[model samples]
Target: MIEIESVTKSYGDVRVLDDVSLTIPTGGITSLVGANGAGKSTLLSVAARLVPADGGRVRVDGMDVATAPGPVLARRLGVLRQENAMSVRLTVRELVAFGRFPHSGGRLTAEDHRLVDEAMAWFELGPLADRHLDQLSGGQRQRAYVAMVMCQGTDHVLLDEPLNNLDMRHAVQMMRMLRGMADELGRTVVLVVHDVNVASCYSDRIVAMREGRLVAEGPTAELMTPELLRKVFDVEVEVHELAGRRIGVPWS
Candidate 1:
C-alpha cells in the first residue's frame, strides 16, 4: 500500500502537486486520469520517490519512501517513468536482466536467470530477446521496458503512461496483461492513463486529478459518471453502458 499525505511539488513558482493525499491499497490496478498538466504524473513521481516533494510524506506499506534505504525500497517498489531513453546499446534480454540487479547485485544467480526468462516470456519478448533495444519498434520497446519492471519482482509497480505508442490492439492487450498481473500475482499496479474508457474498463479504481490536486477517487463504476469526467477533463463526454462496462464518448 502507498500512503501519500499532504504531498506537494513545485517547479519554480508553478506547483505541480498540492496537498495531495491518497491511499493506494494493495493487490489491484488503479488508474490516474486527468488533463496533461493535472499533476497525475507528478503525483506518481512523488509517491514513487523519484521526485522530491517539498512538503509532507509518502509511505509504502509502513516504509517511509523518502527516508527508507534505497535498496530496501527498490525491492518493494518498481517505477517506470514516461521518459525511457537509453544511451547504452543492450539486447532485450540484457535490459530485462537489469531488473535482477537489486536481488543479484550485478551477479545473476540461477533463480534470477529463471525469473528473467519468465518475464521475457510473459511479455512475449522471447522472439526478440536477442535483438537490441534500438532494433525494436516503439511498441516492442515499450514491452521490453514493462518486462524489465516486472522482472524487478516488486509488490508495487508505478507506471507513467504504460499505453503510450501502441496501436489499439496492443493497447487493449497491455491493459489486459496488467489486469492479469494484479489478479494472479496480487501485485499493486498504479498507472497514469489519458483514455477514460480504457481506465473504466480495466481499472479497479480510478483517481482523478486536476490543477495539481486530486479531485476524485473511487471504484471505476462510481468514478466513470459523466459529471466526474467533465470535472476532471473539462470536456463534455457521454457515459454509456456497453458490454458490462461504462465507456465515455466525447460530445460530437
Candidate 2:
C-alpha cells in the first residue's frame, strides 16, 4: 500500500497540498480526479518522489520513499508523468527498452528483451516499433510511453493524464488496459484522470481533490453522487446505471 500521512507541499508562499493524507491499497485501479490546480498531479509526484514534499511522509509497501535508494525505489515503483521530453530522437523500441535500465543497467539480458517484447505487444505497438516518437500520432506515442512503463514491471504504477491525447476508442482501450494491469497482473495502478465518467466506469476507487485537499474518496458507486460531484467540481452531474456500470453524465 502507498501510505501518505499528513503530506504537504508549497511553492514559496502558496500551499499546493495542505496536510493531505490518503492511503492507496495494493492491487486495484484508483483514479484521482478534480479541477485544475487541485494538486492531483502534485500529490502523485510527491508519492512517487518525483517531487519533494514540504512535510510529512510517503511509504510504499513499508519502504519510505524519502530515504529509499534511487535504484531500489525505481525497481519497486514506476511513474509516468505528464511531461515527457527527449532531446535526442529514438525509435519506439529503443524508447521502450529504456524501462529495463533499472533492472538491466543498460545491458538488456534475454529476459529483459522478452519483457520489452511483451510490453510492445500489450500496447499493440509492434507495427510502429521502429518509428521515432515524433513520427507517431499523439495517441500512439502515449501508448508507447505506457508500454515503456509496463515493461518496467513495477509492483506499483502511477500515470498522470494518460488519456490526454487518446480518442474515445483509445481512451477506452487505455482504461481497459489499466484495469487489466490491476486485475490480471495483480499490480497497483493509480492514475490522474480528468474524465469522471471514465474513472467511474473503470476504477475501483475514486479519490477527488479540491483546493489542495482530499474532498471526497470511495468506491465508484459512492463517489458518483450528484452532491459529491457538485462539491468537488462546483457543477451538477447525474449518475446512471447502464449495463451494470455506474456512469456519470453532466446534469441537464
Candidate 3:
C-alpha cells in the first residue's frame, strides 16, 4: 500500500500540489485523471520517489520514501516517468535489462535473463528487442519503456501518461494487460491518465484532481458521474451504463 500524507510541492511562488493526501490500497489499478497542470503527474512522481515533496510524507508498504535506501525502494517500487530522455543508443533488450540492476547490480544471472525475456514477450517487444530506441515508433518505444518498468517485478508500479503515443488498439491492449497484471499478479498499478473513459473502464478506483488538489476519489462507478466530470474537467460528459461498465461520453 502507498500512503501519502499532506503532500505538497512548489517551485518558488508557484505551488503544484497543495496539501494533497491520498491512500492507494494494494493490488488494484488506480487511475489519476485531471486536466493539464492538475498535479496528477507530480503526485505520481512524489509517490514514486522520483521527486521530493516540499512537505508531508509518502510511504510505500511501510517504508518511508524520503529515507529508504535506493536499492531497497527500487526493488519494491517501479516508476515510468512521462518524459523518457533517450540520449543513449541502447537496444530495447538492453533497456529492459536495466530494470534488473537493483537485483543483479549489473551482473545478470540466468534467472535475470529469463525474466527479461519474459517481460519482452509480455509487452510484445520480442520482435523489436534488438532495435535501437530511436529506431522504433512512438508506440513501440512506449511499450519498450513499459516492459522495462514491469521487468522490475516490483509490488508497486507507477506510470505517467502511459497511453500517450499508443493507438486505439494498443491503448486497449495496454489497459487490459495492466488489468491482468493487477488481477493475476496482485501488483498495485497507479496511472496518470487523461482519458476518462479509459480510467472508468480499467481502474478499480478513480482519483480526480484539479488545480493541484485532489477534488474527488472513489470506486470508478461512483466517480464516473457527469457531476464529477463537470467539477474536475469543467466539461459536461454524459455517462452511459453498458454491460455494467460506465462509458463516458463527452459533450461535443
Candidate 4:
C-alpha cells in the first residue's frame, strides 16, 4: 500500500497540491482523474519521489520513500513520467535493459537479460527490439517505455499520462495492457488519466481531484455516478450503464 499523508506542494505562490492525502491499496489499477491543473501529475510525482513535497510524507508498503536508499526504493517502486526523452541515442532493447540497473548495476546478468527479453515479448516489441527509439511510431515508443518500467520488476508502477500520444486504437491497447498487468501480473498500477470513461472501463478504483484537492475516491462502480462526476469535473455529466459499466458523457 502507498500512504500519502497531508502532502502539499507549490510553485512560487501557486499551490499545486494542497494538503492532499490518498492511500492506494496493494493490487489493482487506480487512476487519478481530474481536469487540467488539478495536480494529478504533481501528486503522482510526489508519491514517486520524483518531486519533493513541501509537506507531509509518503510511504510505500512500509518503507518511507523520503529516506529509503535509492536502490531499495527503485527496486520497489517504478515510475514512468509523462515526458520521456532520452538524452542519448539508444535502441529499444538497450532502453529496456536500463530497468535492470537497480538490480545489475549496469552489468546485466543472465537473469536480467532474460527478464528484458520477456518484457519485450510481453509488449510485442520483439520485432523492434533492435530499432532505435526515433525509428518507432509514437505508440510504439510509448509501449517500449512502459516495457522498460515493467522490466524493473517492481511491486508498484506509477505512470503519468500513459496514453498521451496514442491514437484511439493505441489508447485502448495501452489501457488493456495496463489492466492485464494489474489482473494477470498482480502488479499495483496507479496512473493519471484524463478520460473518465476509460477509467470507468478499466480501473478498479478512481481518485478524483480538483483544484489541488481530492474530491472523491472509491471503487469504480461507487464513484462513477453522475452526481459525483459533476462535483469532480464541475460539468453536468449524464452517466449511462453500458455492458455492466457506468460511462460518463459530459456532452449530454
lDDT of 3: 0.94
Model 4 lDDT tens row, 1-252: 999999999999999999998899999999999999999999999999999999999999888888999899999999999999878899999999999999999999999999999999988999999999999998999999999999999999999999989999999989988989999999999999989998999999999999999999999999999899899888999999999989898886
Cα lDDT, model 3, residue 141 = 91
Q: Which regions of candidate 3 deviate over 4 angstroms?
A: none
TM-scores vs. true structure, each candidate: 0.99, 0.98, 0.98, 0.98
Kindly report which residue stretches of model 1 are placed more than 4 angstroms away from their true locations once superposed. none
Residue 250 C-alpha lDDT in model 3: 85
lDDT of 1 at 70: 87
lDDT of each: 0.93, 0.92, 0.94, 0.95
Tens-place lDDT per residue, model 1, 1-252, is 999999989999999988999999898999999999999998988888999899999999999899999888999999999989989999999999999988889999999999999999988999999999999999999999999999999999999999999999989888888998899999999999989888999999999999999999989999999899899988898999999999899865
Query: Which candidate has the highest lDDT of all?
Result: 4
* TM-score of candidate 1 against the unseen true structure: 0.99
**Tens-digit lDDT string for candidate 3 (1-252):** 999999999978989999999999998999999999999999999998888999999999899999999999999999999999877899999999999999999999999999999999998999999999999999899999999999999999999999989999999988888898899989999999889989998999999999999999989989989899999998888989989899888866
Sort by lDDT, best first: what order? 4, 3, 1, 2
Worst 10 residues of 4 by lDDT: 243-252
Report the C-alpha lDDT of model 2 over 93-187, residue by residue, as the tens digit. 99999999999899999999999999999899999999999999999999999999989999999999999899999999998888888999999
Task: List candidate 4 segments past 4 Å from native.
Answer: none
